[model samples]
Target: MFLRFGFVVGQAGIIGTMAIVLFSNAITLLTTLSLSAIATNTKVEGGGAYFLISRSLGAEFGGAIGLVFFAAQALSVAMYVIGFTEALVGYLPDGTSPTLVASLTNIAVFGCVAIGAAWTMKLQFLILAAVLFALFSFYAGAWTQFDAGIFLQNTGSGFSGGESFWTVFALFFPAVTGIMAGANMSGDLRNPARSIPLGTLAAVFVTGLIYISEAILIGGCRDRETLITNNLVLSDIAVMPALIAAGVFAATISSALGSMMGAPRILQSLARDRLFRWLQPLGIGSGANSEPRRAIFVTFLISQAGILLADLNTIAPLITMAFLVTYGLLNLATFYESITKNPSYRPRFKFCHWTTSLAGAIGCGIVMLLIDWQWAFVAISLFAALHWYLSKIDLSADFGNVTSGLLFERTRKNLLKLEGELYHPKNWRPFVLALSGTGFSRPHLVVFGHWLTSRTGILTLGQVIQGELDDRHRRRISQERMLHAMIGEHGLNAFPAVVVASDYVTGVEALVQCQGLGRLRPNAVLLGCPLSVDRMKIFGGLLRNLRGLSRSAVVLRRTDEPADDWKPPSGTVDVWWRGRANGELMVLLAHLLLQNEDWRGRELRLLRVVDNEAGIDEVRNHLNGLLKAARIPGVTKVVVSKDPELAIQTTSRNAAMVFLGMQPPNIGDEEAFFYRTEKLAGGLSRVVFVQSAGGMRLES
Candidate 1:
């Protein structure tokens, strides 16, 4: 592709343009160094690039890249087998067909791999020897015809084939990618940590030197027109043309055999982690050495179909993008580890630096876009989608994913910065500790917690398992697991936490006082109102404790029945404005809920109940001023009624939720206040009495 686009120097001028070999190898050299750095730091086992990335960046990213890497390797198998077939057909008698040769070659390669990785690896040595001999013969023959004066010939194609330098780079870039052929055998090696870096880098250096030599040979030995017209210039100039053919066959077959062994191992690793549960069958091995024979058979089927159906040019760009993306991610993973300066990042192979990893990442990205922006975007999008899917699966693996460590480091730094800063009401976000039993029993309560903390803050669902102190300790682990499963089943972002206590009151007291590390301590508490008055007394006591702790509280009670379909509440949110702290907190929460996409178009009505018509205008103006200053988009109203409970019920009957202010339940003999609160929410959907301890004012 590069030669057609005028990117390459003509054969006679290749000596001048030999830097292309350096340029290509430079990309791999960066990857090799970065790979070596990470491999040495971590205990890398199988999955090759996938294992390294997942261990650093986490499964979602690792799984996504693994999918792409597997495809690239599998397609490489087809590409190589077809390459061998092309060489064989080139040297065959007139009656031989290319398709038949390709089919037979694919079968042979697949059969060798099916025997297992042990035999395939053994065969590689013999193939490598043939490859070396062929290279020797070609160089010897080329040197006999070589002339230094040929370097001065015109090498530009002048867009003869409507291709550019980037297109050429894309085509030839895959040639330098054979470095991974050794790295992919990491699973088979007993000491991948020691061997991968040494073996991979050595191959890269040797291959690079060979490529540069070939460029010089082609430039100095062959004519420009002849090189331009015939890509088989190596065969033409070789001392024995047949040796060139034999080398091509050996090289392509070796690559095919390598991929056949490597790709399945990736699939096996992915399945072992249950990243995609449906793919678990691929992880089952049939050999005593745990050869991925099942995975191998699957790989063979995929390659066979590609060999028969795919065109080489069509598959080339895809393979290029996949490898480029993998290389970029690998570098990014190492760069993250280095920059974070995590104490765990010490590598046995210490030659790597953060700057090099970053450069490698940037180089991979730039080349991906430069080669073909369209394909680059497509490949990136596909990986992003895969990551999203894997994240949803919540594949359980302890890869020591780097994101957690990065978060920890950043959080520590931010906490240190925050220590010197003064606390402000404007920065207050609801870090809520919501008490609940089961989501199935209290669906509305869970949904309410989600809405309150949707995008702005953290909401942890705290479940207190009441039992004898001794037995509670024994059952805590099992109970926590069940609680976590419930949280997962409900698909809530809210964390599930369980604590055991001797009694309900003690449990509530402990949960209310509990605090997470650093700034993660809960600033608010939420709970569903109990049906019985006795149960209400228990919640009332919890509220009193929370008030003393200076934590905001929300007690919710559903007065209106849920829809028969039982979907989450969605509609208008009504907030009753009293004044100062309580009103501001209630309105702020309602507005925060509006910020979510689900509640975007929903109404937020700020309502005030006045005793008579005389105070109606004043209240409306005050409420309007508050709304304007707070910048909360909502309607304002004043209801002049003798019975405020009737007014509230009528105004917010169809609303999704109603927020009402109550005098601190623990402060006064608020039986009348409590009675009126229940009466007001009698006909409303879901009513929450919000009490703000302090720090509730808007920025004004």
Candidate 2:
């Protein structure tokens, strides 16, 4: 208040400066309330704001903001030390350098913090008493000098220094940013959740009243020229100038000590999480209470760098930008927690609403830009880069975060909305259920299903654990995890579903019927081509059941090539257009496959075999027209042959994958149908026998 209050009053005048103070404090108060809500909801530990944010927002978000917040706190030490130097410089000998004074002040603060938070906190009481005494003296002296005419004159803004309202706002925002100082000391507190909200809120209210009263009193008593030219006007207006000087020393040093203590704890928390390898050494605590001595040394070095900058205003905006970023993210985290309605987010502090958090976030962002757009851009960009880097590290948190809850809420709403919309062929997307057992065992089946979906649709890797639910419940869970790990290992965009039943057939049936939710339910079922005759019979039965349920089925017959040699298919995808019943679905699936990066440049060939050459031209023309109508890139071929299966083998021998239309066998002819499919897929690299159960279309 002593350092920048006069500057703000000078630039924005009495009313404008008071308004900025009120606005900044109001935003701070709302943010504090949001912090209170989150703090009360969980068991907050040592890291204070960092702990709360990381626990609520997940590791990546928390880690990134944690580092940024640490930087803000470390630099704040320099800002406050510079303020202390400014106050002490007036009493120093002639020609004493302000930078030298700032350096010394920083060292003193470092020494105080090095002694530990207990000793530093003990000093805060004396500092608070001095500050209160200073405020009393200033108000007492200001009342004697106050005149109605001067008060009226200073009420409106007079921009003589070419300073804007936002610039002044930036100077004053740091005063309220200290509300988190107590939160940063959460580790040292007896009960963080209870202490943080009450203590921090009370500090905000009391300080806000003090700041507003001081602004009004100073502006009413002092002339504009004096306010603008003098950075130490408070001392001149005090009943005892020496008391005001003591207050300046006390307030700035107290803030510097607070930052010095808080920043290291934040760094220590980050190091403890092992987010960055180099920070691991700093994670080690020195004593019984786990003091962050190493982190303190690092923070001291950063503060010394900040103090070297020498000017309070220069360091002030940088600290403001960092704090705004941290505060804005905190608001967003709280807003997500509330909006998602996560049951675990129940807070004893109910005064905060989601809208308040939203408003606080938006207000912080707007203030950041208003103060300095270039700085805000740099700050936001740096934050984004850090977030991206942390996300890439794949950090995991032990506690639940709002990200999953937010996604689940959004998915729930979209699913319900989709449930109400009428289905249309034009809007159709393949929702595939790949019954690939453990997925790792039949990697080809899972990979093919993912390629078929192409991320525009949903692909679920389903496993059927054969046993009773009570007997194999744990196995089902383990297999589900394995399926998910398989998807991650293969880098496939898919979901996993595992079920336990008495037998393979029952498990498959259960998966087919209950794999997805609402409109997101699977429309296509993919399974590997059975190797044995008995398994083929079961596969045939499954196919019949799927057709009866109007679900398209894809049977993948992989070659005997070694798994090491197997890779994403790269050559042509041949589609044998036997009839519209399966041809359309086959064409659509091929198009979807080509959408994936693995099959991005692969060719699509639509082929048909005619018994004779009499109508070959007509067949070719129809295929070309179909491709044109479908707006899919592919070549057309018409082959004249007596045997259709032989023609397919001869034409697509070297193709990457073959898509053929198939019909389910009659009730007692599963053996014959299986033999025919085996013959058709003979010597093929990969064959996918597709049977459409109607409703699928290529052209709407």
The local lDDT score (0 to 100) that residue 516 gets in candidate 1 is 63
TM values, all candidates = 0.59, 0.61
lDDT of 2 by residue, 1-700 (tens): 8756977786788899889989999889889989998887776778878888888887788889989999999999998888788778778899999998888878888888888888888888989999889889989999898888878888899876567777778767867888889999888899887899999899889988888888788888888888988877988988998888888888888888999999999999888877788888988887778889899999999999988854676777778888899889889989988876543455768799999999999999998988889989988988899999987775644555766544433567666755644443544667888877764677778778877775557788888888788889888888888877877887777889888888887887888888777766788999888877777787888888888877899988887565553367557999999889999999988878877777778899999999999998999999998876565779999999998889999999988889998988887888888789988987887899999976655544
Clashing pairs in 1: 2-168, 5-163, 11-219
lDDT of 2 at 25: 90
State the TM-score for model 1: 0.59
Task: Tell me how far candidate 2 lies from the true structure as C-alpha RMSD in angstroms.
Answer: 22.4
Residue-level error in angstroms, candidate 1, position 93: 4.5
Best by lDDT: 2
Tens-place lDDT digits, model 1, residues 1-700 = 1122112556214633455667788889999999998887765777899888887787889989988899889988888888778667756899897778887888888899889888888899999888888888878987888886764454433224664555556656777876677677777888887899999999889887877777766767756766667766777777887777777778889989998989998988888877888889888877687888888888888888888798787777788889899999989999988876443465667778989899889989998898889989989999999999987765666555556434533566666644433343434567778877643356666677887776666778877778876877767777667767877886667777778887876786687677566545687778777666556666676677778888888888875666641354776889998787688889888877776666778889999999999998989999888776565678998998898889898888888878998655554444544566667778676888887887645532
Candidate 2 residue spans exceeding 4 A from truth: 409-700
